[model samples]
Target: MTLKQDTTSITTSISNPTLLAKVDQLRDLNIGQHVPLPQLVVVGDQSSGKSSLLESLSGVPFPKDQNLCTRHATQITSRRDKDECVHVRIIPGPRASEDHKKQVEAFQTKVSSASEFRDKFVDILKKANEKMGLRTDLSSGHGGAIFSEDVLKIEVHGPREDYLTIIDVPGIFRTTVHGTTKDDMVMVKNLVKRYIRDDRTIILAVLPSNVDIATQEILELAEEYDKNGKRTLGVLTKPDLVMEPTMRASVCDLVMGQKRPLTLGYFLVQNRSSDDGVKTVSELDQGLRIQPWSDLPKDRVGILALKEQLQSLLLDITRREFPKLVQDVASQIRQCTVELNKLGPSRQDEREQRSFLSRMAGIFQDRARAGLAADYNAHSSFNQTDLRLITHVVNLTDVFNADFQRLAHSRHFSSLEESQPLESPEPSDAGDRSESQSGLSVDTLRVLLEESGVDKISPKEQMELAEILVLPKDIPMPNEGFTDWIKEVYLQFRGLELGTFNPNLLSVAFTEQSRKWGDMTRIYMSRIIVTVHRFIAATLRSICPEEPTRIQLWAEILEGLLDCYRKAMAQADMLIQVQQRKQPYTLNRQFAADLSKSRGHRITALLRPKAKEDRRFAEPQYMVNLDDIAEAAEGKHNTELLQEEIHDILHAYYNLALDRYIDNIFQLAVDHSLLHGPDSPLKVFTQDWVLNLEARQLEDIAGETISEKKRRSRLSKKITDLHNALKILKSRDSY
Candidate 1:
């Protein structure tokens, strides 16, 4: 059997050894044989011992230490053209600047000056290392080091005939993400987040035996992958460096325990010099030959023992745990697709339901965030942004609907066209979205919604489908600038005045963050995740029947969603109060009525009264003062007083915005509570509360005017109050 195309597969051989034994001749050169698998990704922090552990796992030695020890992400696939089937083939991680051809240039340029790799690559790379602030494994030169990058592919054939693909990431230690600016932490965060988020990926943290516990940086990095039960394994690499197994065990326990999502497994491994097949340094002869670990002492001989333990653990994880994950992905794909199809172009009821639920979820989340942040004026901005974002996001459904339309129009399709309907829906890459038939998100929604109804899709299905949607990548960068506004307001509360540069408070100035979720939304990012939770519940229900996964899982999910919604409601409620504060009595009563009304019923009703309120509350000198305020100087006429006056004018604007932020958060919290219970806080709001807030605000502002001196005095009082408020919050639990 050829490595590239063999009837033998890693799993197939494990379950059926007859195939593996038949290929023992191992001397045939063929390319068209083998069931191929995707390359495995081994990721972790640098010097986490990834290299040594990978070699040990694969039972193939290539290079050691920091010596060319994965300077680039490498893909270890298979190549069977050789007489002997190669076990693994490596393709280095693609660099974005690959086309620059810097490494290739240096290779060719200096190599022309000399024939030896040592004379060219090693020497040039050494100097380049210094310039790049990178480390070089310059000892014997070409051991595990890499310099050229026309895609350095490495092939290794193992004794066990396990032809599996593997990916070796560049050492995270030296891999400092280069950023162009101070606030460019976004780019670094994005890169790190990407590496950690790929659900298909597994994290392999390799550390020296001396690394008794992971540092906060590494732990935090690892936590990014912890959610969704991503498999993270800790390897005490260079166990040869540490003399005791007990020490290795202790380190693994401490590090793994401290990490968020518990690691899949742990290993103590070492790489002996020269010859490779992953035996302990003590097990190998000076020439580096593999040896069966005999009755050797545990201390010196245990690297081999450690290797055995890791292999056993890996075997169990692959055979048992990993398959369940794959199954979950499969189920989610089916469910999402089914639901989306129901809401497709033809299903008016489903589409309407989908639309309502989508709006419900959105408005709730928006209010929740605003309320949580105490940003009263955020309501309007959120509504405007929501209008804009949804306009674009819902448009994507049209894209999905259009496709479903074609399918129904053409084939009267009962199933999506594919090799296996069970396959996980593939997401579209940023550059090539058309390639994937439907995103797992799109498919899950369509399928599930379609299936839920008898002759038509059920309302529950529509909501579930919409809920399962993959967040659209194309929503024009939402008013992340609002985050800056939040920071500004926070600064103002701290006596930093209205305009200030405050970094500590503005964590991630872009408000493109997902809403603070209830447990449900948090777990439902992938349509697949929902599917898994359902599958577990469904399958288990067959045996132990009453454990409703939906109600159980969703109960928690709902609580969080409601928390978000309540926050939003409170915010919107506050903003109406602010508007009322400035309005005349009759207008204030109208504002109260509108605030109490359901947000969607007839926004016009809410707006008419509020617009009248704004009119009545309008300062007699509003426009002229605004123009004067806009034209205010930066001269030495007591800038503070001028600023204070400007601040008052802006406060009106700010207060309006604060309402929106708070409302959004409240809504988000409410979204989580949907499935919690009938009496869930997520239950719709009454008009009374909104009106009450308006009345209270009107009373509060009875003597409060937006004049220069009044504005200054109010600012002083509010600032002091806010300081104490923040202190209480901090002392409570540091939300």
Candidate 2:
């Protein structure tokens, strides 16, 4: 056959070049670097005739030898144009440094004829391999970098070419032989898998008919990714070598889909080896027309039929994926644009740096204001707990108040009798304390007589009570039992010729009752400090685009935020000091009411006449009758009444002081000084603060660093290229 007829026999006809060219354009823009694009990828075992297949399909003679193997991924793209031309270039990997990328991209060549391409291809491959840090010799060890992920891109344009693009990756191999190490074997396998694993890629599984298909690693990987064989097309190569009937029938069964069935089925093709003289397509077709191959389907044979199938399949895939490709490109464009915006414009000089700082400060203030006001609708960040300033403040204050009510007292009184030790308190007996309400009531003062079932007392109190209870009964139990410990104090401090004890006793008892105020409030203040720090960080991250910038700004203002927090803590400490003043005093009406009610309860319980022995055994009872209270008031137990009076007064004053102190801490220290007022930590990054900064300080906080500028430039270029890609997809005209 003549050369024209031979070329025409292998040429793939294209009905819709526009769709394929759009795909080729997207691949040219390197859109696949950011996202996976639809295309055909050739994968197989080492020396499996993958290069021979590419040569047949592209009509370009590739350098071939028995020991030669594909060293890196090669992307071959062919498009229809007026003149026949070839262009080769290197597309750097993602991890390549900027300088290395420039050096790699600088390697480019152009050829005007097929003969020139064939003559120069081997030398070009050798150069590309050496540039990738590998020796050209397949069995020689010369470099540390054994394998690469970079791609060698070749663009072919000619009047007779079909619009097609195929990515050929390094073949999978089992043994680490020759120049290959174990890591190199694994790397090649991983590289092939990465390309074929993309759903948009159509896998061309090349299998040699001379070898068992099951043993080939490429088919296993193809099945692994394309489980149903939906996107995979099987290509049987070296069919001329299967001479035996049994072996030929096995290959034919695969070709006819009788064994290991695939959705796209299989095709058989004969590739010319290096030892074979210049052979025509007619000779290749005649070889496939023999007995076992002729019995197989006609559509699944020869190089021309395989080319036609590949082109049609690729067109279908490109058409189906075009809209999605456009959408992905647009989405990535928006993302890159947003990243560029976050980096903001160049901030080289102090004025520009100050301007950038001012803008950041404005954003910080807006977010901080919204967070402090609980206006969650203002910013999405306010919904986060660490950034919800007001909500955390309220929750923390409520928790602090509850902790004081439950834990502030050194000892607690229990109403349960010794026999009913584990029973829960009656609902009516539970106290309802709040920030504005007193926590103590008559139920809180029900001191246990036997002391066995008393709740909330420490181990120390229990030990002391045990010692007191063990005292001899003949030793005047009135001043000996646990109940009269306070009476002993009153007696010791009594003034001359008076029924009342000295007022100093009240101050001393009250001071001891609220003694934990300092440590507890300090802990509470520390918690608030943490909340402030978190809020500031969350707000800054939401406002700043880069991590380094956020870190620098944090360093600039971290000390100030802490200083404001410390000042607020000092103010809170002042409130605690007020609770420890020389005299216990309060004007709250509730204190007097609580005191009177407790006194009446104590007096009535002490003076009631004893019940009958059987009735007392049936149920525990307390004296609550008005007549009993009046009778108790008329009795003469001066020391007992005086002790009970002192206890009641101390409890009432404690409850009143606790309520007011919690309010003071929240309003004066937390709200006024730390969060919202003039000393607010959020105000540390204001516009005025930026204006006051020195030139060096401004640059340190806001100036863009070398890496940041490089990142910005990269993103800008990516966005511009993606936009251009989108336009290419939208264009309706043919090239």
The top-ranked prediction according to TM-score is 2
| lDDT per residue (tens digit) for residues 67-171 in model 1 | 445454344433222234322112212231434434333322222111132223344434443333233544433333233222333343333344344556554
TM-score of every model versus the real structure: 0.29, 0.64
Query: Local error of candidate 1 at 118, Å?
Result: 14
Scored against the true structure, residue 425 in model 1 reaches a CA lDDT of 28
* Clashes, model 1: 100
The Cα error of candidate 2 at residue 326, in Å, is: 2.2
In lDDT terms, which candidate is top? 2
Instruction: Give Cα-based local distance difference scores for all models.
Output: 0.36, 0.74
lDDT of 1: 0.36
Candidate 2 achieves a global lDDT of: 0.74
- What is the C-alpha lDDT profile of model 2 across 1-735, one tens digit per residue? 111216563454787788887777777667777878888999988789898888777755656542336777888988878898889888877567778677778888899965577677778877876776665565667654666777888888887677778889988888887767898888888888889888889999999999988898887899899998999999999988888889999998999889999888899998877777777656676788888788887789988788788888898888888888888988999899888887787787888899889988998898888888888899776766667777666655665665666666544432223333312232321223333133333233222111222123346433423321112121111111323556667777788736677899877766666677777777667556656766787788888867887888888987787678778878988888877766988778999898887665654345545322344555855535566555655665887667766777776787788788888988897889878889988899899999999998877888889888788778987998888888998998886
